[model samples]
Target chain A: MSLAELQRMTRGRGEPRVKQETPDNKAALAFLGPWLVGVVALTIGPMAASLYLAFTDYNLLEDPRWVGLANFTRMLGDERLHKSLEVTFTYVLFGVPGQLIVALGLAVLLDRGMRGLTFYRSAFYLPSLLGSSVAIAVLWRLIFGGTGLFNSLLGAIGIPSSTSWIADPDTALATIVLLHVWTFGSPMVIFLAGLRQIPREYYEAASTDGAGPWKQFRSITLPLLTPIIFFNLVLAVINSFQAFTQAFVVSGGRGGPSDSTLFYTLYLYQEGFGAFRMGYASALAWLLVVIIGAFTLINFWASRYWVHYDD
Target chain B: MRLTTSSARRTAAAAASIVVLAGLTACGTGSAPGAGSDGAAPELSEEEVTLRATWWGGDSRHPLTQKAIDAFEEKYPNIDVVGEFADWGGYWDKLATQTAGGNAPDIMQMDELYLASYADRGALYDLERTAQLDTSGLDPKVLDLGRSEGTLYGMPISTTAFGILANQDLLDELGLELPDTSTWTWEDLSDFATEVSEKSGGEVVGISALNNGYSLQLWARQHGEALFSDGSVSISPETLAAYFQQALDWTASGAAAPASHQAEMAGVGLDQTDFSTGKQALAFSQITQIPAYEAATGGATLEPVKIPSEDANEAKYSYLKPGMYWSVSSTSEHPAEAALFVDFMVNDPEVGGILGTDRGIPSNGAVRDSILDGLAPGEKSAADFVAAEEAYIGEAPEITPNGASELDTLIARYLQDVLFESQTPQEAAEAFIAELDGSIQSANQ
Candidate 1:
């Protein structure tokens, strides 16, 4: 139903509906009790505590001393924090879009009635399941080391590439970006579901109107898939912002080769755990939340222009 | 609708009050270290007590430590010890989190660089007041290395002197006798390394340039300064630049592995270092690591020589470093039991025999003498090197200041910049000093 029609209907019968729904309120609240308790105890509680900690000078071993805004001001002069921001932004700018393109392309390929669809889907999904794992990061290090499989393959073709992909500062961040892009399985699955929901009759209608595949995709599929694309875009942006494990494992926790692969979260970890500056780390954490929140909010605001939920 | 809204407001109010109650309870449970328990008079009891002992090492060290723990339990009978071990990379991060949570193990293995930090924060128990821990057999100098401010916070488990580890097979292949380390200067050593690299057809570098702060400390001492003194950078920027310049020259002269190769070898264990892997003729190592290098080379003859000095008979660069310490956590429920365990690990010949020198040469004179006869040839050489170097060894520098652990990585990062030619030695040195001073100041704050 359209918004105007629903609003008119609600105004006419809202009081009677509320009176009827009151009888079921106890059952509804009982069902929600577990979820409500969890939010109050775990999520909201820690978030509130962390928010308070962001303003203090806490070294974990000692009690937090309120230093008010000093932690935030320190960022103005922190060279490492600036470098981390640059690195994390670079990853998100390139990685998220690259991942989405690959995911959509794969989903389109699978949308065709290929044989053994389940097997192919699972095979493709395996990387996303294992992508953030320490084992995969270790495997990636082996694949990109000075005398690793990648160089070996290059040598087979007579190129003789001897550079350590993960050790060279020039190529270290790029290697991490490739690792992020390699895990496109989750978005691809979502794309596949979205594709399935598009009625086949729309395509048939387009075909009858003499629309070719490209034209149909541009007019029908593209516009219809915007909502799903926007959803994936938001999630990918947030995930890339918080990327840690790959860089941490690959760099051996020092964020070295000149700190080229120091993700924002990894740097925060180094400050909090490695340097024992918990207050500064807490401030950095809050800054990250603001940045991620701003990006997500922008994405939602922009979605109204393109996303189509109804015909 | 009105009733539902009112009920929702009431629910919100209840949650807010519960959260306030939770915050208050959490504040009450902050458990000040050593406050709840009678720290000075922890009673020894026949009642059953279990304690967690944590340390970091390779696969070999883990089993030996566990064996020692098992022996301690057998001897005490009333105490059950649980072992926690991790590789060095994740060890500090885990320890910090556990300590902050007030769940640190009863006994923890600690490094000198981190000893003062933990001790100053009141996370470590004062061994002098523990009563059960007997330190009469330990050298006073060695014991003092574990002290912060005025009190002993950790017990020295072993002492290892820093020196050079040479691959004898490669040295012999090149038909070169070991340089006379007692009189050789850095210049002479560089020449010797260049000759080795040339003779080996560049298959082996003469030396693997280390980005270690300990190595820098030795170099600084040779120039009659300390890397750190009284919680500040004590060495001049000129000395540091010259040290890094020497490393750059080694790379330029093909006496050290290329920058990319060195980066790959950074943080690798003894088994994978270039010297152990037969890719370098000499590498920086502690006396305690000689056995592990020998094992990695499958019984190849590896020898320890003194770290070369800058002047003839003027530099006292070598000192015995407490390999690591056995510390009792301030939060440990059984401080007495933990202290007894440390004493057993140190003085018990059976436990010493099981552990050997994996933790470095035993700090106790009796334990060291007892284990000497049973030592393998490789282990004997390391122990002998320590004995021979005793006359030349100087006073141990002050326990590394807080933030000193980060200096190693900072030095390595700048060293890489020098090797990669992104920064000159002078520039790297200046940046290093600035960064080190900044970290030290912040850490002190």
Candidate 2:
């Protein structure tokens, strides 16, 4: 629509509105220039390339040739791809909730009037900063390895477990889940901030009405904190789906113990770099985008029923 | 060495977009010739060329390599060599990315698995065309192993022969005897291992499972088959199944560490293995890793012994394949200088003396002899072992064709299936062969 038409429509609705350039138009455009370049260069450009590459046979070395839907067709019969999807979905389903529960619990505990709040917050926040790092993944492996710290602890308790938890098909993914839960620091901080934003007067009113701390939490604290919970859930879902490094590191990039920890992203890497089937890897990448997008959309649809706001 | 690489892929995706970033191989025989094959240093320009050389190794390698580079700089004052290195997995990932970006290092240390992959993609310069890299000093058989499409793309740097590194100290402590590895059959070894497990009350396991792709390859060779032939998964399913059967028997019979422990150990470097940690009595590894294992075990006496065979005749399956190679990038601007540097690495006594048997027994006979006296005790014994075993060494097999670089991962996955009882050996082998064949077909397409 033309500027005059937009202005006329606004004017017809209510107060007369005018469309004109702001004083900072040039400055704002200049300020956004670098970001625009970045979007076109890094994000949009690669995404467009990936979209195109998804349909063609591009091995990242040779020139891409047209191969219509072969990569996708191949995925239909791929057992490993299916396994990876299952693994990734399970990780998201269990990991996001597990992490959110841990995060929310710690956030509530810390939201109390406690001394050294800053110290506790920093200490609790540390894992998220180092969570996806290679060093931490190696540490996680050692902690759960057959002869490592965890087994030693078991031995000390006279349980005498010798299983390398990260190396057993039954327990491998569990260790990663625990690792995911341990890195709940970021969400806890968010939840803590959200808890603070819930005015104390609500709890006081609940108390006057003869509500216990548990009742106060269930009625007052929870409803107001749904937005943050929703926010953390969404972020956790997306991040967990894209989880790669921990599985890659712990499995040594083979996605082993019978492919129990084969995250979708790790499978994409195996196809793209390990197998040099960049075309198939691209198809896998687009599939993940679709999967994550569909889930996020579903989350949005579901959030409308539960999420609440003061306004 | 193993390095669980950082989540660089995630960072790359976030920072630069998806992996399908823009780039194409500059399609052509883009490489130019290097120096002449005069068995002398390439004539250097006075302009002071700077070349980047990269390799993968553990902690001890970086300093020794830098010291060798220092010597090379002294020899060719005008050429400055910059060194880059990483653990095995990270090195390949980084090198692949760099090559895709057309910014690959001038010199790269290539593995048998990946040498063909890179060269077939025209990512490596042809050494014969370069004329600067002299192959005359090395055995022609060793040199030919580095060739692809009848073109010499990489030069052999050293030799690798897979063996069982027996921890004599561990056996001695337990009052058990190290088996006569030369005469022992696979069945004999298993029974002996079972005894060790029983004697030790299951504390120290007898051996590590055969999870290394090299061991599988050697096993196939012993059975008169090949894991791969002509860029295809050509091993008979029966052969691979038998290998898996041995693994199953070892685990079931308690002749080796449990599958859980094997899964953990399989993904690590020699230095971190159960054998190196002195928890296990044996490990199957390349003969070159003796020093690293000794150092890891705090100077424990580990001796290299032949892998089990039916007889001396079957011992011919053991071959001194190139442990690794030195290749100049096809896109290198300083190919001549890079060629000279690689030449020095292969032939110079100074480099070999400083490097010792770290890279393996030297590929050049003269340099191998020259450095023998200067080697440390473990390295010297390892070198002596390689020399002694030469009589039994088989003809070096062809470097695995392009698409087989991932065979290790493929085999390890299938082995896990067998261990978990999720698949029978025959079933896992059948599935593995199908998957491996498809992988090769797709890459070659």
lDDT of the candidates, in the order given: 0.84, 0.83
- The DockQ of predicted model 2 stands at 0.43
lDDT of 1 by residue, A1-311 (tens): 68965765568643354343665677777898898788777777666667777897776765677899999999999988999999999999999999999998899889887999999999999999999999999998889988799999999999999898888888989998999999999999999999999999999999999999899889988888998999999999999999999998888876767788889999999888877888889899999999999999999999989888975
lDDT of 2 by residue, B1-445 (tens): 0111134334435545533343433322233233223444334467989999999987878999999999999998988999999988789888877776667899999988888888887778777665567778887778888898788888999987788888889899999887666678888788888888888998888876687678987888888877777767777999999999998998998888788888887788766877877888877888888888888899999888888886655447767778899998877777778888898999887788888877888999999889887888888878877887777767666677887788778888899899889999999999989887777677787
iRMS of candidate 1, Å: 3.7
Q: Per model, how much of the real contact set is kept?
A: 0.38, 0.57
Q: Report the C-alpha lDDT of model 1 over B1-445, residue by residue, as the tens digit.
A: 5688688767866785677455533432136555345545676778999999999998889989888888888889999999999988689988887776667789999988888778777788878777788898888878888988868988999998788888888899889887788777778888989998999898888997757777888888888889888878888989999988998899889988777777767745677777877888988888778878888887778888887776775666667888899998887888889999999998888989999888889999999999999998888998999888778767777777776667777788788888878888898888888988887787677
lDDT, residue A300, candidate 1: 94
lDDT of 2 at A222: 90
The list of candidate 1 runs beyond 4 A from truth reads A1-29, A205-211, B1-43, B174-177
Q: In CAPRI terms, where does candidate 1 land?
A: acceptable
What lDDT is reached at residue A80 by model 1?
A: 87
Looking at candidate 2, what is the lDDT of residue B219?
88
Q: After superposition, how far is residue B373 of candidate 1 from its true place, in Å?
A: 0.7
| Per-prediction interface RMSD in Å | 3.7, 8.1
